[model samples]
Target: MALPWFVKRYPDLNFPVSFPPELLSHIIRDVCYNHDPRHPAFRRACCRMTLVSRAWQAVANSTPSLWRYLLVEYSTSQLHLAAFLRNSGEAPLFLCFRANAPIAADPDMVRQSLLESAVYISHTIRRWVAIDVELKDASVFHSVLLYLASLPSPPLRVLRLACAVPRHADRRSSFAYGFHGPTLRQLALDGAPPWSSPSPPTVALTRLSLHQCSWPNYSDFFEFVSLTSALRHLSIGTVRFAGTLPATVVHLPSLDHVDLLFGSNVDSIPVVASLFSRLTYPALLEVAISFNGYGSVSEFLRTPLAFRASSARLSGICSIDEDFADVYHRLFGVVTLDLSHGQRAMVSALSAEKSHALPLPSLSTLLLYMPNWRSLLDVISSRNDGQLAPLHLRCNYPEHLAVTHHLPHIADHDLESHHRVLSLVSSFSWIHPM
Candidate 1:
C-alpha cells in the first residue's frame, strides 16, 4: 500500500503513520488550534476534519460528549427534529419556541424515537441537565409535552419553561402522569396562566419556582402546591393565599425552607401568620420573604417559629429598611443579609433629609447596590467616616455571585443548606426639622 497518503501532503510537518485513539484528538486539536469554535470557521473545520480518515472518523464518532448542549428556535419543525436527533450524536437538545406558534410534533414518531435513542443513550449519555422551552402560547406546550411524555427522560436534572402566558388548568394536567424522574431536581415556570384553577400537584421535585402565574383563586392555588410533598425550596413571584395551605403542609418533615416573593400583594402575610401559628415545622432553618405590599415583619418575627430558623430574609419590611438600629440589634446573629435590589428607591426617597446614623456592629456579610456608597457605609459602620469592615460586598459586574458567594438572606436556601445566613437592617433617625 502507499503508506496512507496524508503524510505526503504535509511532508514538512512529518505526520505520524498511526496513532492510538486518544492521540487522534491531539492531531485534530492542532489542525484547528487558532480557530475559535464560537466562530463559523471553527465549526467548519470540525466538519472537514471528520472526513479526513477512517481513524479520525472513529474519534469523531466517539466524542459525542462534546455535544451536551441543545438549542432550537420556535420555527424548528418537529418531524425534522427527530431526524436531526437520530443523526446527531446523543447530545442533549435545547429548544426555544415562538410566542405564537405551537410545538409541531407527531406523537407516535416522538415516542418511537425516544425508545430508539434510549437503547443507545443509557450507556452513552451521563446527564441531561436542562430543557428550556419558550412558547408563543400554552397550546404549543401540549404537543411538545405529550410527545415527551410518551418518551423516556429519566436523566433530566433541570427543567425550565417560559411563555408569554401561563398554561390553563386543562393544559397543566399534562404533567400529572406518564412522565416521572426520581432523579429530577430543579424546576422553574414563568409567565401568567390563561385560565385559573386547581392544577395537578407536583412531587419529587426538590426546588420549585413560579413567576407571574394565574390561579383561579386562593383555594385553587393551595391545591396546586399540595402536590409538592418533596419540595425543599419554594420561590414564588406572586403568592396569593386566599385559601388553606393543606392541613398536612407543615408536616413536610423534609421541608425546611420557604421563600415568599411579593406575597403581601395577595394577603399572604396574614396567611403565613396563620400557617406558622397553627403548624410548626421545627426543622425549618431558613425563611426568605419580600414583604412588599402591606403588613409588618413584627408579626412574623414574633412567631414561635423564629427560634427554629437560623437565617431569614424580609424584603421591603418597614421596620428593617428605615435605618432602625434596634431592628439590626435584634438580628445580631444573622450571618448574611442581602438588601441589594428591591427597596433601594425607598431608601433614597427618605435618606436625603435625615441625620447622621450609627454603623452596624455584628454584620460579617453585607451587600450594597445603591449609587450612594456613603449611605451604605453609614448603615454598615459604627462611625460616619464611611470606612467599611472586611465584610463581603456583592454589587455590579466585575464580581457577580458565584455559588459560595451568594448571601441569599433566607428565601433561596434549601433545607440541606448549613451555611450561616445573617442580615442587618439600616438605622433611620428623624429629619431633625431640616
Candidate 2:
C-alpha cells in the first residue's frame, strides 16, 4: 500500500497525535467538569473517553484525580465500583448517594443494592472529602449512617445529610458521629439535628446552612453559632426555636452575608429579632430577610437590630406599616437599597416622609419593583445630599417607558424645581433585566 510522504515519515500516528498523554488527560478533566450537554454527567463523559482508544483508556485509568468524585447509582456493578476505587488511588473523594427507588422499581431491591455499594465504600471513609446522603426512607438512612458512624472521624470538608422521611426517636442514635476534623469547612444538615459531639477544636468553618433542622432550643443553635467564629456566610431556612435567645450577644467578626427565611405564621419574629440583636457584624455587607407574616420588619429594623451592612433587601414588609422609612434614617451609610419586593403604598409612604429627604446620606443606587415610578422619583428627588447613582428599575417595558416618559416632569415643589433632579434623571440608563 502506498501512503502520503508525511505519513510515511512519521509511520506511527495517533488520533489526537499532537497532544501528549498529560495534556490529553488535562483536556479530558476539563471536558468532564464542563458538563457539556452531550456528556451531561461526569461519569458519562469519563465512560465515553475510555472508549476513544487504547491511549485514552490508559490515560483515563491512570488519572486517579478523575475518578475521585463519584455519584453512586443502584445500577453500578461491583466490578465498576472496584475499578473506580482502584483508579482513584489515595485522592480525596466526593460522594453523593441517594437510596431512593424509582416508581417502577422494587424498594427491597433498591435497598439491597444500596447496602452492597455502601458496604464497599464505607471502608474508604478516610478518603472522603465531601459527602451528600439523601434518603426518603429512614430505615435505609439508618442502615447507611450506622456503617458511616463506625468509621473514625472523616477528613470531611463538606457534609450534607437530608433524611426527609420520619423515623422513631431511636433512629437518631445512628447519626451520633462527630465531625471535629480540622478541615471541615462547610456543614449543611436537612432534617438533621445539630450533632451532639464536642465542637471542632479549630473554628475553620466558613459556611453553614441549616434547613428544617430540629434544634433542642435557642441555646443549642446559639452555642453552635458561637463555635464558628470564622463563619462568613450563614443561611437558616424555616428553623423554629422553642426558647428565647440568650441575652448574650454573639459577635462574628468575619460574617458578611446572612439569609433568614422564616416559616409562615410561626411567630419567629422575637427569635429572629433576638438573634439579630445578639450578633454584631462590624464588617457585614449584605443581608436578605423574608418573613411570612407582616407587621412589617420595622420593629426589627430599630436600633438594637440595626445593620451596619451597606446593602439591605427586606421582603414582606407591607406599605401600611409606618416607621419603615424611619428605620433607614440610622443606616446613613447604606449605598444600595433593594425594595424590589416592597409594596407600592410603602414606596409612596417612603416618598412622602419629610424625614426621608436626609435619612440615607450615602444611598446612591435605589432598586425598586414598584409600578409607582413617580413616587420613587419623588423619593430620589427628596434626598438632600448624595451622588445619585443610576436607579435600578426592575420592571416591565411599559413601566420602563412610563418612568422614562415621566422623569422630565418634576413638580414645582420637588427638588425646588431647580432642574437638578431632572438633570439627575437624565443621567439614568436603563439597566438590562436582572
Best by TM-score: 2
Please report the candidate that would top lDDT against the real structure.
Answer: 2
* Candidate 2 structure quality by residue, lDDT tens digits, 1-434: 23323334443432223332221132222223334324445455544453213433443465544443444333434223433344444422444343223211333543345433444444434333333335554344434434443334432322333344234422422221211212211221111122344433222345665545455676766655555455677766555567666788766546677666555535555656766777777776766666534544666566344455556656654443555555654653443444656556556665554434343333345555555667766554444232333343444324354455444332222111232222122333221111
Reference-based lDDT, residue 181, model 1: 22
How does candidate 2 score on lDDT? 0.44
Q: Positional deviation of 268 in candidate 2, in angstroms? A: 1.8
The number of clashing residue pairs in each candidate reads 20, 0
Error at 272, model 1, angstroms: 3.9
For each candidate in the order shown, give its overall lDDT on alpha carbons.
0.39, 0.44
How does each model score on TM-score? 0.47, 0.56
lDDT of 1 by residue, 50-118 (tens): 321343344345443222222222221222333333344443432221112323244343223332233
